[model samples]
Target chain A: MTAAIELNAVEKRFGNVGIIRDLNLSVAQGERHAIIGPNGAGKSTTFNLISGHIRPSSGEVRLNGDVISGLGPFEINRRGLSRSFQVTNVFSRMSVWENVRCAVLWATGHRYAFWKNVDSLPEVRERTSQILDDIHLTHRRDVPAGLLTYAEQRELEIGITIAGGANVVLLDEPTAGMSHAETDRAVALIRRLTEGKTLVIVEHDMSVVFGLADRISVLVYGHIIASGTPEEIRRDPKVKEAYLGEEAH
Target chain B: MNATTTSASNISGKSAGDSLRFYGVWLVGIATLILLPMIFSSGGSLTSFSLIGIAIVFALSYNILLGQTGLLSFGHAVHYGLGGFAACHVMNAVVSHGWPVPLPFIPLFGGLGGLAFAMIIGWVMTKRAGTVFSMISLGIAELVASSSLILRSVFGGESGISTDRTALPKMFGWTFGPQIQVYYLIAFWLVISAIAMYALTRTPLGRISNAVRDNPERVQFIGYDPHVVRYIAFCFAGFFAGVAGGLAAINFEIANAAYLGAIQSGLVLFSTFIGGVAFFFGPILGAILVTYLQLGLTSVTGVWQLYFGIIFIGIVMLSPGGIAGLIMMHRPLARAGTLQTVIPSYVVAAVPTLALACGVILTIESIARTHSGQSSPINLFGVAFTPASPMTWASAAILIVVGFFVARLSWRRVADAWDRAATIARDRGYLA
Candidate 1:
């Protein structure tokens, strides 16, 4: 079976400096994969390259064995890949329900429909409500996404990322500012929501990475140093020296 | 099981009530439109009402761009003007060819005209939003406005194209020669267009448009091209703008270069912004106030446009949400029954506010009249005063100095009262 997400020799350069160089990463279908790296490891850049936010300077990204490089973000999205920003990026002015519904609209095949009322669409309403419930935000459905608590907004971010029912999901530092209890809740939410789907998460938290990822990849500088199961990755000396360091022991 | 069933039934009951209130408001609006002419039977008032209706449509269409899509367009009048010209031509052709097309159908043709131009232009303009979109729209506005003067045969040069509305085939035996008949015709379109625009806001496209407005990048990741959403909104705005333009053409019996001018574009922008861009009914309120002010102020002062500029600036700085926003700000207090606390403070503030306004008006009128070298006495609040009088200047200065100081003090009290009322409202769970 083809990898769900494949970045083959993907190189990204910003002006004179190289951000990502000769990066080769493969995430298999139905696997919860984590890319753990220190600051400036080009983890977010890799997410951008794969999601088509910024084009790779060289090489190609593949989704389900099909080359998706050079496609616009929406085009890439339509091919069943969705992503969330490291920052809590959402339609801040729109209500929680609206933010989730917006993600669900295109996936449900209601493209640019001006004739039918959105509230009357049962499938959309059901799906939106289900996601809101899953994210434990049903009570805050009427509140603007911007007004939500930090952890709640992070949950909303994950809800939106998975609301489209995309097969491939990429979350960038979803629990960056979250407390321990909040991070546990978020990890549980991510695990539940991304079940049976391909997840490629870039995270800094070692506990989330070890607990949630089916497989782990440690990135150093602009290249992947190791890829294996969490046990094998914990024992990899290079990963320990370069990234894991004192935390690994 | 019992709880779920009761909740379901309650949901259905609430929606039914909501729909009832929805239709009730629309019914009341239609009734008001129908009875307005009966109440104000004079020709001048009828004419004013007709202008207000056209302006309402135009401003609402402009809001679809500015408010709904967050596309700030400077040349929206191009669509309006082109639509007017198209309708004028169609009416003339129908009259001369003896076609049986009725007058009510002309606005549809105008809408088609606007749509055609929008589809062509919007494809290019909506490629990049923000500063690029705004600049391109400005350029296009200048281009179209200049073309109106150059394209003499089509635009009718300086005089513009005129048609006889009475010559069109009759609807219900109303030839539409009388101003009242035209007023009714405009009212009908206004209601239809308003309903359609409001309905657009509830649709999937409408919801996505708001998302695009808030964050275009996020919209793209959700499998939507923000550019396409903006283009769709632009086309709709153009269509409705065309309808407004067609109505204006029929009302005036003329379509001129001025219809496509920058001033006309500015007027729509002014009305929509002042009314508030946040709500559907904002532009309507704005259009009514602007139309009334345009008519009322033109007769009273030569510097009316200057006053419009000042009012627009004031709304932008003080109340960015416009009139609708201002009114809605009091909703929580009203719902919580805490509004009474703020009312006394508001009343106290009103005295100095009125004095300050009068003082500013007096100062402006005096300066404008004197600068223009017009010897005519300026009539303000039914009191005629010589522009050259020292007493007029002194009184204006006194009012400004005193009113400014007093108004500041009173406004502080109003703010204090508002905070107390808002706190009460929050405690009552009526405020977020």
Candidate 2:
């Protein structure tokens, strides 16, 4: 079977500031993977590349057997690749429900379902409720998503990201800002949502990654210096010294 | 599944009973609109009706950009004026040269001209949003307005342009002379154009435009080019504005520089705001009120400009939602279940609005009375009137007092409606 996602010698650069270079990694089907590294390791860039927010300088990115290297984010999303942002990017002015419904809208072939009262779309409503329940945002569904507490807003952002039903989900630090309780709640939600998803996350939280990821890749200064199963990565001294000691987490 | 449909999110408080009430109001609104022409029983009234129809279409088109899309174009008249002028040119050519095309087809020529112009300007203007975008639209307007004088041969050298509407189709029994005939013709086009514009808002392009307006970066992330969204909206707005301008040309039997001039641009802006920007049909209501005010106030008081200015400023400051915004405030209150308690406040609000209206009327009449035109004293409906009269001052004082109370009452209603509406929206799951 084709890898769920493939990056073959991928290279990305922003005017000589190389974000990713000669990076090669494959996310196998149903694998929960983590890319852990120091600052500027291009953890987010890799997410951008796979989600098609940015084009690779030279390399191929394949999602399940089809190349979607230079496709726009929505197109890539349509092909089952959805990603959340580092910054909480929920629609501030619209209700949390409207924010979730927009995700349901782009997918599910409801593009021109005007005249059907937007509130009454069964599929949209159903999916939006599921997203809300999964993220524990049911109580705040009516509130403008922007007015939510930071942790609640962060959950809604993740809820929106996966609301599109993308098979492959790129999560760029879902627990960037949170209390211990909030972080644990987020980890639980992520694990539940990623059960059937091919996942890649950039996280500084080691316990969360070790507890969740099937595999982990160590990226250091735009290069993937280590890639293996969690057990193999844990035992590899070079990997531990280059990543854990130099900028240990 | 709608958060709003859920018990937690049902902000409309609209259960089956409320839905029935909502639909009742909606049906009544539609029924009244259809029945309106009956009230104006005479054919002559159709003339006034059509003027409002054209204003409605024009202001509605203007609102799509300014209100919905959050754009402010100072030179929006470039299309209105240009469309009218182009239609006039088409009329001049088609009639004098005997092009043999039907008369209704004339508006298409105007629409196409406006579309082409908008396509070019929209490309440049849509590159940015908000202040930068507004500046570009205004610049384009200034550029075109200034050129109308230089391009004397075509623009008619500041005298503007004119055409003969009667020169069109005599194939049918209609000679097109009666204002009533043109009024009906315009009414048909107005309805068609308004429907088209409203439908446009419900389309994918429309959704994308709103999305782009709210969060262009998000739209880009979603793979839509924001510029493309802007271009489509621009071209569509131009098309309707063009049609409206064409009707304006046919209405007056003339089209000129003034149609595309700075003042015409200002007139559209004022009218759109007066109508309220939120609802699709609000501008239509706005145009009717504003045009009537301009005409009625001008006849009664010489300083109609002052009246227009005061109303314009007041609406902008006091009623940013326009009339529709005010009307829409009802749903939130009904949801809150406290609209009954606000009834007294409504009465208080109406008092002040009436008072202000009279204050404005007197203030303008006072100014106009003292102007040095030195014309003969005019007969006021029952009494002869001149400047600097004790009687006029006394009458003005009474009007001002009445206006003060009326305005006070009006504001009370406004505040009560707004406050209760807020509470209601919150109760119904719409707010934080």
Candidate 3:
């Protein structure tokens, strides 16, 4: 079967500095994968490249074996790839329900419709409320997204990312600022929502990485030094020296 | 499946109530429009009402960009003026060719005219959203305004092109020759346009426009190109502006260079912003007040435009949300029945506020009269005073000094009362 995402020798540079060099990564369909590395390892850059937020300097990026290197972010989104930012990014002025509904609109093929009332669409409304319920934000549906608690905002961020029903999900540092309890709840939510879909998460928390990811990739200095199961990754000497060893302290 | 069915039923039940309230508001609005003429039958009032009707459409169109889509346009009058010119030409052509088109259908042609130009201009203009977009709109407004003077055949030069409204085919045995008939015609179009525009805010495109306004980058990740959304909104704004322009043509029977000038653009912007861009009906209130002020002030004072500038600045600095925002801020107190707590303080504040306003007006008027070298006695609030007299200057100075200090003290009391009411509202769960 074709890989869900394939970055073939993807190289990215800013001026003369190489941020990502010869990065060849493959994520299989329906697998939960984790990418862990030191700070400035270009994990976020990899997500940007695959999501078409930025173009690779020399190599192509693919979604489900189809090259989408030069496409715009919206075009890439329509092709079944969705992502959440490290910083909580949302439609701050819109209500929580509206933020989710915005994501659901395009996925349900309600593109550029001006004649139909959004509330009158039973499917869109149902799907939106369902996602809000999943994120446990149904009670706060009427509150503006900006007013939500930080942890709640992070949940809202993940909710919007997956609300489009994209098959390929990329979440960057979803629980970065979350408390331990919030992180656990978020991990459970992510696991439930992304079931049977391809998920590639960039995480700093070792517990979340080992507990959630089916397989792991270790990135350092813009290159992956190890790719294996959680046990194998834990045992890998190269990964330990480059990343896991520092976390051990 | 069971959850979906129950939730769907709940939505339907809730929407039934929402739709009732929605239709009720529209019905009240329509009834008021029908009764306004009965209450105010004077020809001058009818003319003023008709002008207010046209301004309502124009200002609301402006809000579609500034309020909904967060696109600040400086050249919206181009569409309005172009639409007026198109309506005038179509009216003259219908008469010359003996076409059977009536006056009621003329605005639709004007809408099409505005839409066509928007399609051409907005294609390039909507690519950028912020300062770049504003600069381009300003440039385009200048281009159109200057071109209107040079394009004599189409624009009619300085004299403008005029047509007779009575020349159109009669509808319902009304020639639209009388001011009341024209007022009714305008009122009819205003209701239709307002309803159409309001309905648009509930649509998918409308919600997405709001999303784009809040965060354009986030919109991109949700499968929408912000540029496309802005372009569509720009076109709709242009179309409604043109409809207002068409109604103006029918009312005045003329289209002129002044119609497309910077002042026309600024006035629509002023009305929309001052009315409050945050609420749907903000521009309606704005259009009515601005239109009344424009007409009433012009007759009462030579420096009427100066008052408009001051009012605009005051709204921006004191309450960025405008009139609608100010009214909505009191909603929680009203719902909690604590509004009376703030009322006495408001009354106290009003006295000094009125004095301050009178003082500012007196000073400006005196200076204006002196600058113009006019020695005639100035009549203000039923009192006549010479502009050159030291007594006039001293009274103005006294009002300014006393009003400034008193108003400051009174406003502090008002703010304290507001806090008390707001706390009560919060306890009652009326405020968040």
Encode model 1's per-residue lDDT on B1-432: one tens digit a residue.
Answer: 011110011121247768898789899999999999999999889999999999999999999988888899889999999999999999999999999999998988778778888999999999988999999999999999999999999999999999999999998999999898899999999999999998898889998998888899899999999999999999999999999999999999999999988999889999999998887888999999999999998887799899999999999999988887788788779999999999999999999988898889888888888999986887767877788599888878888999999999999999999999999999998777
- Which tens-of-lDDT digit does each residue in B317-432 have in candidate 3? 99888888788788779989999999999999999988888778778988998998876677777888788589888878888999999999999999999999999999998776
Locate the minimum summed-lDDT window of 10 residues in model 2 chain B: B1-10
What are the per-residue Cα lDDT tens digits for candidate 1 across A1-249? 999999999999999789998999999999999998889889999999999999999999999999999999999999999999999999887888888999999999999999998778999989999999999999887777777899999999999999999999999999999999999999999999998999999998988898899999988889999999999998888988998784555
Score candidate 1 by TM-score against the native.
0.97
lDDT of 2 by residue, B77-134 (tens): 8998788888889988888888776566677777777777898778888888889988
What CA RMSD would candidate 3 show?
A: 3.7
lDDT per model, in order?
Answer: 0.90, 0.75, 0.90
RMSD of 2: 5.5
Native contacts recovered, each model: 0.71, 0.11, 0.64
> TM-score: which is higher, 2 or 3?
3
How many clashes in each candidate? 0, 28, 0
What CAPRI grade goes to candidate 3?
medium
lDDT of 1 at B282: 86
